[model samples]
Each structure stands twice: as C-alpha cells, then as structure tokens.
Target: MEEKRQTALVTGASSGIGRETAIKLAGKGFQVIAAARRMERLEELARQVQGILPRRVDLSDIEDREKFCQYLSDLPEPVSVLVNNAGYSIRGAIEDVSLNDAKRLFEVNLFGLIRVTQACLPGMRALRFGTIVNISSMAGKFAFPMSGVYAASKYAVEAVSDALRIEVRPFGIRVVAIRPGFIATEFNDVGNEMTGDLLARTDPDYKPVYQASGAGVGKMFVNATVPGPELIADIILEAVMSDAPKTAYSAGFMSKVFLEQRATLDDDAFDRFLTETTGLTDLKV
Candidate 1:
C-alpha cells in the first residue's frame, strides 16, 4: 500500500541544525516547510531538499505569530511535526545584559516557540497526530557564567517541552526536547550582539579565571565538536519516526556527559565541580 506523506515545519531552517533536520526529513519523504528570516539561504535550502517549501518568517517577531499560525493552519495536509529550532545565545551576567536583548532571546527561544506550538495544537489535535521537537542546548541544564540569558531561555524551553509532553500525550501529540552541545555555528559569533560590552567585562579580579574558563570551552568545541547541521537533523528525523522516542534527547559528545552530570549532581558536588572547572575561588560577586 502507498503510505501518505507527512509534513514538517522547521523554524531556523536557513542554517545549522534546523536546516539539516529539514533536509533529512524531506529526504525521508516528509514534505517540509523551511522557515527562517534568510530567504536567500532558505531558497538555497529549498533547492537542496527534495520537496521543501521555503518561507521567510523571523521567529523572533511577536507580530508575525498570528500570520505564521494562520499559514500553517491552512496547509493542505496538517503539520505532523514542528521543529522549534531558531534561537541564539546572549552571553552576559543577568544584570549586565540589556532588557531588550533578554527579551529578544526569549522572544525567539521561548515565547515564539510556545506561540507556534499553541497555534499548531488545534490542527494536531483535530488530526490526532503530531510531534513537537524543541532545540534546547547544554546550557539549558548547566548555567555557564556569561550565558545567563541564553541559558534561562533554553531552560524555559526544556520545562515547556517536559510539561507539554504530558499535556498533549492524551491527544496523540508528542513533544521531544533536543539538547545539543556546542556545535560550531553562527551562535558563537552572534552571541556577541546580545552581550554588547558586557562580554568583555567580568569581575576585575576574576578576569584571569574567566578568561581561562572561556578558553577551555572554546577548546572543547574546537576539539570535540561533531558535524553540524546534518548530524542533528538525522537525529530529529529518528525522533519523529520512532514510535517510542525518548522524551528528551541530548546529542553530541559533551552534551550527553554535561546533561548527565547536571542531572545526577548533589548541590555540593556540582558547586565544587563548577568552582574547579571555572578556576574560581571563594569570591563573592
């Protein structure tokens, strides 16, 4: 018997994990709609995917929420999957980051993600089938010094994915949280935009410790990084098709270890580990 084709909507499809996931899904016979602000990149992606529809929609904008929802609602076949993959890191302490930057991070990472899920819910419920894959990060589990805002946003995403999984299971909808470790991407570079001057500033006395710690993280990414985009995309494809997919998935080498460590931590041990790893001593902020 010929099977019906499923449709997936992937946000942040112009680049990185979202782009790769979209391609993988399309290759696996799912009709894909690749949404991102970069229309030229998306156009290129559309060419690459077997049967992908490319659309330019910035997930960060609150105003476009309704329009995007309406577009998906009117799709020929109901959207069977949604990859909430558009997000960027804002590197700074909470107090050092601007309110606008914080808002922008959450607008895409949390608010916009939730908005799209809410918008897609009716259709999913009506059809009695769907999967929601949220692209969280390792920082979602462990708070790095400069990534407070970004970590908070991803933490929110992790929480939402956890709760929504149970809430929608009765309606035949599944939510999967994908926590990726540091894969080389534009996120590393673009993190500067959100941090502004704050990234360069740490406690005057703790500068050396912070510098060394940052270097360690950079070295880890450079040394142990996995293939970007396609590797993550293949995982997403598996998550969508597997009847018994794990509620949460942590991809990449360091990501799995970091998340495991975070989950299994005693407060004292975690504190000690953090202090040692970051080269911190008994210093108060």
Candidate 2:
C-alpha cells in the first residue's frame, strides 16, 4: 500500500547534522523542509537531494523567526517530524561573555527552539502523533571550562525537553533529545570564529586559565577518533523513524565518557573532575 507522504522540518539544515539529517529523511520518502540562515547552502542541498524544500530564516532574529514559525503553522501538511537543530557556541568564562551576547545566544539556541516547537505543537496535537528531536549537546549535562554560555543554553534545552516529553506524550507527541560531543564538523571552527580572540580581550588573569584549558582540551582530543555528522544524523533518523523512540540518545566523540562521568559523580567531586579534566584545577593566574 502506498503511504501518505509525511513532512519533516529540519532547522539548521544548511550544514552539519541538520544538513545530513535532512538528506537522510528525504531519502526515506519524507517531504523535507530545510531551514537555515544560509539559503545558498540549503539550495545546494536541495539540488543534492530532490524533494528538499530550501528555506532561509535567521533563527536569531525575532521578526524573521516569528515569520518562519507562522509559515510552519500554516503548512498544508502538518510537520510530522521536527528537528530543532539550530544552535551555535561561543567560548568564554561566565564573567567574560557580555550580557548582550549571552541574551543573543539564548535567543537562538533556546528561545528559537522553544518558539518553533510552539508553532508546531498545535498541528501535532491536532493530528495526535508527531516526533520532536532536539539536538542538545553533551554540555547540556555539565559545564566545561570557558564554555559556560553555550552550556547554559543546552542545559535549558534539557529542562524543557524533560518537561515537554511528559506533557505532550498523552497527545502521542514524542520528544527526543540527542546529546552530541565533539563531532567532526565546521561547528568547532565556527565557534572559534564567533568567540573571536578570547585571550586577547579577556582580563590578563584569565589568559593562563584559557591557555591551560585549551591545552587540556587539545591533549584530550589528541588520540580521540572524532566521528562525522553522519553518526548523529543516523541517530536522529532512528529516533524519527521509530515507533517508540527512546527519550534521549547520546553519540559522537566523548559523549559516553563525559556524560557517564557526570552521571556517576556527586556535585563537589564532579566539580573537581571537570576542573581537573579541563586543566583548570591547578591553574593560577
């Protein structure tokens, strides 16, 4: 029997996990809407995969995001699957990141996700069956040195996912959180660029702290085998395609090791472990 064509929306679909997931979903006979700030890339992806509808929207902008959400709400076919994957990271100590910058980060990483979900929820509830996959980072579990801003946003995502999962389950809406760690993507380079030269502008006392943590992180990844976005895209696809997907799935490099440590350790002990792991415990400036 021929099945009804289902629509799937993937935010941040211009690149990395979003891009890959869009391709995979389309290949599985989904009508995929690929949304991102980069229209050219989305266009390219549409060319690469037939049946992908390229959409350009800057999720960080309130006017633009609302317009996009309205479009989602008005879709002829309700979005049966949604991947809230648009987010970026800026490296800095909590004291270093400006309030304006932090607010902007949350606007995209947290607020945008929440608003988009809101727009889709009505349609999903009307249908009484849908899947929401939120791409939360492993940082959602614990903070790392100089990553407080990004981690805070993911932490908020974790909280929302937990609450929404139960709230919407009665409606047959499933929410799944995918926590990735250090995947091989332009994500790291983009984060570095967005953060700018951190040590150059930070307080002199923070220089050594940054250097030591950088070195600590560098050393840790020296022998690690970083996987590509396909690994995570595959997980997202599984969650979307499953009859009863798990509430959460962890993948990519360092996800298991770090999340396990965070799960097992108590507060003070975890604090020490994180500081030591990031080479900040012995840092003096």
Best by TM-score: 2
Per-residue alpha-carbon lDDT of model 2 for 1-285, expressed as tens digits?
Answer: 988899999999999999999999999999999999989999998988987999999988999999999999899999999999999999999899999989999999999999999999999999999999999999999999899999999999999999999999999999999999989988989898888998889999888988999998888888778999999999999999899899899998888889999899999999998888888887676
Clash count for each candidate, listed in order shown: 1, 0
TM-score of each: 0.92, 0.98
Alpha-carbon shift of residue 85 in model 1 (angstroms): 0.8
Candidate 1, run of 10 with poorest lDDT? 276-285
Cα error, residue 249 of model 1, in Å, equals 0.8
- lDDT score, candidate 2: 0.94
Off by over 4 Å in 2: none
List model 1 lDDT by residue over 100-122, tens digit each. Answer: 87898888899989998888888
